[model samples]
Target: MTSPSHHAPGAEHLLTRVGEVLKPALTHYLDLHAHPEVSGAEARTADRFGRRLAAAGCELTHEVGGHGVVGVLRNGDGPRVWLRAELDALPMRERTGLPYASRDDAMHACGHDLHLAAAAGAADLLARLSDRWRGTLLVVGQPAEETLTGAGAMLRDGLYERFGRPDVVLAQHAAPMPSGTVAHAADRVPMAAAGAVLDVVLHGRGGHVATPHLAVDPVVTAAAVVTRLQNVVARETAPADQVTLTVGTVRAGTAANVIPDHAVLGIAVRAAGEASLDRALAAVRRIVRAESAAAGAPREPEVTVASRSAALLCDPHTTGSVRRAHTGLLGPARVLSWPGSMATEDFPLFGDAGAAIHGERGIPLVYWMLGVADPDAWHRTTSDGITSDGAASGAPDAAPPPAPNHSPHFAPHIGSALRPAIAALTVAALDRFAVT
Candidate 1:
């Protein structure tokens, strides 16, 4: 939930000095939120970020990985700290009735719009206060993160070779937590998870519904596959291993009177470790193929792991430094060390204290959670004890709990999330890029 109109902790002077940037950041945020773009198609989004970065005193480079934007600020070059923001939105409809709600089919349900504006605001603040620290601050707007391909695409396109790897990489994600607060998971592996997009297609012979056994029902096979894969995580995986298997969609027949020739299903698999992920995926393949074969499908079913999200690991040193800095700024109460979730993110591709791109390790990654929920909404959920996923934990609930990321109803409290987010990034950079 939104705080009572607060300034960032221990950053009153700097916040005032760079206060002008927040207005433009708000404008940028609204603009981004209102006109969303999908992954790999963020051309205009890249342009918007590029302009903002340039205004923030960053040297801009475009098209690193399809429309990725890189903004570099060199100040006597001590440590190279990289701050990244996602440049893409989801393909969900914007149901929020705010005046600035997106009119397009796409939506910023994940709060990337806020993250982009925050990165811009931080760049502006750092550039204005150039005397505070000495380092090369690299601000990057990464594309295709929703599809879990942006980081890999950027890496393959010389992201490190051309720009050089960072000494420390920092990022943040918008969470359903109370606005004006932040969360970290330093003790546990913060946000380290492997995820994959699984797509399956089953081929079968079609026949009229009147036929008894004339058709090899791929729909039945798909149903069996879906039902069987549910046990991959619960029954197969070790109790300690965290894993999730979700069958998002399944499509098959055209009508109740006719059996379709083929069926398709989309699945998502994620886990904190590679072994858990591997086991789940293996189970998926086994179940899908086995079900299809048993149903006497026309041919071998198509199973694809469309995308594999990189597992992210935060460096203890870098994460600790950020934790300390944020704790000092926002206080220990506002800054919490929360547990990690199964949700996947592409930010992990940056590596943990090393060069994950070039095979040699060099850079460390640290990503924290920024609360964007409206104060009233978050409090309503807390008072009523809402589930972590923003679902009401109790029955007979008045309404579904506060919306979380990816939900069409998600509307971050930009007024409260923006300033603190900017401050958090600015302070994190200042902490790592200490005055030389």
Candidate 2:
């Protein structure tokens, strides 16, 4: 791996420009956090991001695949480096209590708002230092990432064909770790999980609740299925194989006095490999069918696989290069090795994994986790202190753990996190771009 001292001559200028663009980047983060849109409905978010890219002198294109935005910056061609960030938010409410927190039903609970601002800041800095580097820059705002569908959607819509295939794709995600730090996977797989989302409908006969003997209740069957799903991971899956099955949503009757004709369930499964994921999915289908049969329902249960994606694996060579660049920019202490996670992502589709959609392969991808937690707040919660119950303790605060991704309380310390994130992206892209 290359050392920080061996960075190109332009690296110092890139770091200096990060401070110059911090103010507006923070303003953008605040605005995005206050107003967020959910998956497949990111018109406003896309527009805001597109305008930022345009202001940074990128030739912009909109609506590549369901509100996806693409911006191109060419400074004499060398390596085409793509910096990708998510545009859509989660379908949940924010409870961070920040003055600029989302007031609507949707929330940027996953730090996508932070990601966008950082990408925009990097775009501005890179464009300003255009003469120092030679290459094309592709800044992409992808939508529907919460549903794990946006990357595939964009690829299917000819992301590479229309905008030109990239030599490398770089992305970063916000994590609960302390601010001013970045973590890269130590293994080949950055995210070691493949997942599938399932939608199920249970059918039965409806009648008055008083005449329970005459009516079949699908709600009962749905409950049974949910209970049995736990056994799939606990008893069926190998202990070494990491797997999780969750019934996220369940809807049944309208009135308590009346039995509903059907009940619906939204199921999600994640596993370390495709075979484990397949087995878990199969088990889910079997449990649903058997429960419906046991309930003596008039019709069989319906099951549909809503979305799925393969495990995300980073290009080892590319990742090592970027990791070294990050070390050069942020110092060795701030750059850490990441233990592979079970979090699933559709980002794999942007590389060789989605050869079926893009008809191309060998596009290197580099992803790292950006720390977003406030150092003081994080230390307060993690330090040994008196327990809430008035007892002395040596353990971290247990009353309220640090809010993680997808949590209603998840909030990034923008002041400390934003600049590092921008610098991380800028250095990684600069490392790939030819030094003029």
Best model number under TM-score: 2
RMSD of 1: 4.7
Q: List residue ranges in candidate 1 displaced over 4 A.
A: 1-12, 253-258, 352-356, 384-400
Candidate 2 segments whose C-alpha is farther than 4 A from its true place:
1-15, 384-399
**TM-scores for candidates 1 onward, in order:** 0.92, 0.94
Tens-digit lDDT string for candidate 2 (1-436): 2222226455545566798889989988999999999999999999999988998999999999899999999998688989999999998988999999999999999999999999999999899878767889999999999899999999889899999989899999998877877888765654547999999999999999989889999999899999999999999999998899999999999999999999999998998888999999999999999999999999988999999988888999878888888888878877877777777888889988899999989999899988888766665664563233212243644345468889999999887899888988998988888886
Candidate 2 global TM-score: 0.94
Report the lDDT of model 2 for residue 137.
96
How close to the true structure is residue 170 of candidate 1, measured as C-alpha lDDT? Answer: 92
